[model samples]
Target: MANTWNGSDDPVTRIHRQCRWSTSTLQMTDLESDTTSECTNRWIHIRHLPSQFNIDLLANCSEYPLFDDFCPYLPNHGLGQKTHNRSHSWYRTDSHMLELIFHRRMLEYPCLTSDPDAADAIYLPYYAGIDSIRYLYGPDVNSSFEHGLDLFQFLRHYDSSHIWGKHNGHDHFVVMARPAWDFSQPLSNDPPIWGTSFLELPEFYNLTALTLESRAWPWQEQAIPYPTSFHPPNMALLDSWVSRVRRSRRTTLMLFAGGGGVSASPNIRRSIRLECENSTSTSIGNSGYSKLCDFVDCSNGICEHDPIRFMRPMLQSSFCLQPPGDTPTRRSTFDGIVAGCIPVFFEDQAAKSQYGWHLPEEQYGEFSVFIQKEDVVFKGVRILDVLTSIPRARVRRMRESVLELIPRVMYRKHGSSLGLRNKNDAFDIAIEGTLQRIKSRLAEISVR
Candidate 1:
């Protein structure tokens, strides 16, 4: 202080001193730590930037890098002609598929994973199944990478565990570089004790690859609807409903919602032949007709919601024949109940699993006939006998109940009674609701 100039001193000298001091301080700050210059040309460093923006810029600048990093492309894969805004085959649009878009992106943003045991998140195969074709396109094994050239982001595709292994480098995501299901290998590639995706634990919070199911098993694990386990469309009348569709037109028609079409046995295969439409009889194959109301592969599969063209005849028919696909307890069986047409369960082990929550077994037993698969026969039984015997009054009520079911699955006009299918949306409303509940539960638990 004794050596410093007083207030009357020269402004030039003071200004120079201040400038030098400020410049030294700025240089010190610049040299304090690393910057983007230090990470130049590193892809991993680049990827980390979006997540590693400094605290000062994080509040707003952070989201931009991630949004920019995501796939900047649109899919043009012609799924099918658009109908109901869906791929005409499935229930939604190409944008909803997101399969192609997700696949191409992983190539550019491959997650680095050195260990397969790291638990970070689930690699769900979006929909579910092990189709054979994608295997040729990509590798079908664990302990190996498919050269990772195929474009399927589904955790179920090439990876065997469905337990997406996280890149040890990032705490936020399970960097999955491979599909979880490969057909070329044995089924035991992933054993449950170890490989089962245990995401409910502390791992699955932030994710880089994700898809969600629109519906799920109602949580009371012990609470399965007998003959089926379904949450009726939310729009359905909450009151107990029991009804059957009244058959119109004197003409005979039989619709098979999910017949033994794809995995059809020689006998069940032969049975569709005996059934007739408008006095016209034809075999399931070569007759140029299909027996499926809808042939569903997983939404994860190549065919989404593509109703088997053969199923169209069933829709037009007075009676729809529904049996479970590979498994019995399914959404389709309920669809039939709600459709009001009689169902022939072709009773199997699956029928036993469900307590038969909605089937009118106690009252309208005659409406739904359950014949043993083995007895389906050689009996050469014709469907006409069942329809002729059922009372018209009972049929009308079934139809009423069926119509009631559709609106529950369909979206509504917000404040109106009229309903509609879920227009294309990736942010599944139901999934979001579940996540919100989970988050709330976590918050509540944390407080405790």
Candidate 2:
């Protein structure tokens, strides 16, 4: 469509050029010394790829599966259709549009350097999420590697300037909106199974990749927050949302809004649904247990159509049940945070081990509750009992903490300038974390 970067004399270009660092005697200490200066100065270099990798993929949205129309989500630079007639800023953002959202935000990133030689990190704006979706459920799963291999071959040309050769791409990073496991397929499978073998390729071993749900083991992947429906235009709108949720009159003790399609035996969701029904049945005259739980049966998939149907329960409940979906992570974890509801996770892989860059590891217990999946499924422990056992004072503290974490998990509206006090969003945190990680690696190589 259009050139991704503006002209050389454009405001964004001029801003970066004015603060571009001199690489003649750049030291590791200089990069690590000042965090605020690092954020304001030019450090990241965005690679210019052809439209086929990103913009053209959006143009061909109609070619995707007819059953699930993704065209509505492709507009407004992947922010999706706006929530019409709403006073607050909101959109029907697809969780898989992280690549699109990150790219749009990067266009406005102040720390971007047009000069590759002086950059600390290079961002590959490849939309692997959209590219791999067609291959995921199709019959020709074997052909899934073609587009990734092509992208790898295109980067081989960058070796002429030693861009890819410098430290073997340890300074390079890519955002894959899908789960890390979706691209971690084995090469030796007899009959081709689910997912592409993109991450398994030898060329990407040293690359620092970002995904929504990273694998638990030590690897190149890091987890970033999934895109939720709320994309506040500025800090004022964001603060308004936080205030409204904080002041909400929560009458329900816990809430669960999901489908019961899991056929696996000892299903934790089935147990949760059973407990919710039991709580509703015995609420006639029991003052202590009346209105103890709220349930929204998503088996018919109505929650996916209406955002209010999904988020209202979270706003009105003390705790939101976040059981594992097809994978360990669910978008609802971030959604609950946006609603100022304390998320009760069933597995460590859901949040604790996943989002090290965004969520604090030691402070996880302050905002969320962790109950083992086996305790609910195998031991027949009731969810209402466990949640009710938590003291009211501690629950209030946890909800306050969850409200404070709203900005870190959210992706702000593209090109919208934030107020001075409230600056860093999800994109800012990911870029900062990536740059620091690259700087650390370069320091190790310098001492070697």
Give per-residue CA lDDT, model 1, range 1-448, as digits (tens). 1122234323223323433443344333334345435422211211111111111111121123312211111112212133344321222222222332222222222221222332122222221111211232222323222312122233324434233333321212212212222211332445222111212212332332222110123221111221111112222432222222334331333555443443355454335434432233343323222332222223332222333332233334545554444444444444455444455656543333332232323533444555655555466555545544556676556555555543333221112222222331111232233234334443554587
Per-residue CA lDDT of model 2 for 105-154, tens digit only, reads 77666666656677789888888878887677544466765538777777
Each prediction's whole-model lDDT (CA)? 0.31, 0.76
What stretches of model 1 exceed 4 Å from their correct place? 1-81, 84-137, 141-250, 257-266, 275-312, 324-341, 348-369, 378-382, 410-448
Candidate 2 residue runs with Cα over 4 Å from true position: 1-42, 138-140, 158-161, 261-264, 281-290, 446-448
Q: Count the backbone clashes (under 3 Å) in each candidate.
A: 29, 0
RMSD of each: 19.8, 5.8
- TM-score of each predicted structure versus truth: 0.39, 0.87
Which candidate number maximizes lDDT?
A: 2
